[model samples]
Target: MRTQVRVVSRWIGDEQGVTSIEYALLAAMFSVAVLGSVVTLKGSLGDAYEAVATAVTLAVTTAMALVS
Candidate 1:
């Protein structure tokens, strides 16, 4: 019974896995932050890209008109 108690105490006192757990938590938080940012900016990014595409298309059309 004494040996079992000592083993249990030692196991409870072990710190080897603490760092790994902490790193995992940090990684999870970072992932959540990135995901949230992407979600929040999804519409804005789409609008920006669409505006750029429209501008490029208009420039190309104007250039072609000038060339012709």
Candidate 2:
């Protein structure tokens, strides 16, 4: 019974494994947040580019019609 108590106490004091698990969880959460933001920004930039392209095309067409 004494040996069992000593073993349990030693295991409780050991903390290397717990610290590594906590670091891994924090890194995973940070990576997920960064990836989500990149996806949202990419979609917004694509829409803005398309809108600018359409506006330029319309202006060119109108100017050509007036000149002809």
Candidate 3:
């Protein structure tokens, strides 16, 4: 009974795994932030690409009409 109690006390006071748990939590938080940024940037980049495509199409149509 005494040995069991001593083991339990030692386990409760152990700090060996604390740093790994903290690092895991920090990594999860950083990943969430990065994912959020990427999602936002994805939408903005799509919009920019669409605008450029529309501009190019307009210019090509105008040039073709002039040629015809």
| Candidate of highest TM-score | 1
As for candidate 2, its clashing pairs are none
lDDT of each: 0.98, 0.97, 0.96
lDDT tens digits by residue: candidate 1, 15-48:
8899889999999999999999999999999999
| lDDT preference between candidates 1 and 2, better one | 1
Better of 1 and 2 by TM-score: 1
Candidate 3 per-residue lDDT over residues 2-22, each given as its tens digit? 999999999999987998899
Clashing pairs in 3: none
Determine the C-alpha RMSD for candidate 3 after optimal superposition of all C-alphas: 4.6
Instruction: Quote each prediction's TM-score.
Output: 0.77, 0.58, 0.54
Of candidate 2, the 10-residue stretch with the lowest lDDT total is 38-47
Worst 10 residues of 1 by lDDT: 11-20
lDDT tens per residue, model 2, 4-63: 999999999999999999999999999999999989799898999999999999999999
What is every candidate's alpha-carbon RMSD to the true fold? 2.4, 6.1, 4.6
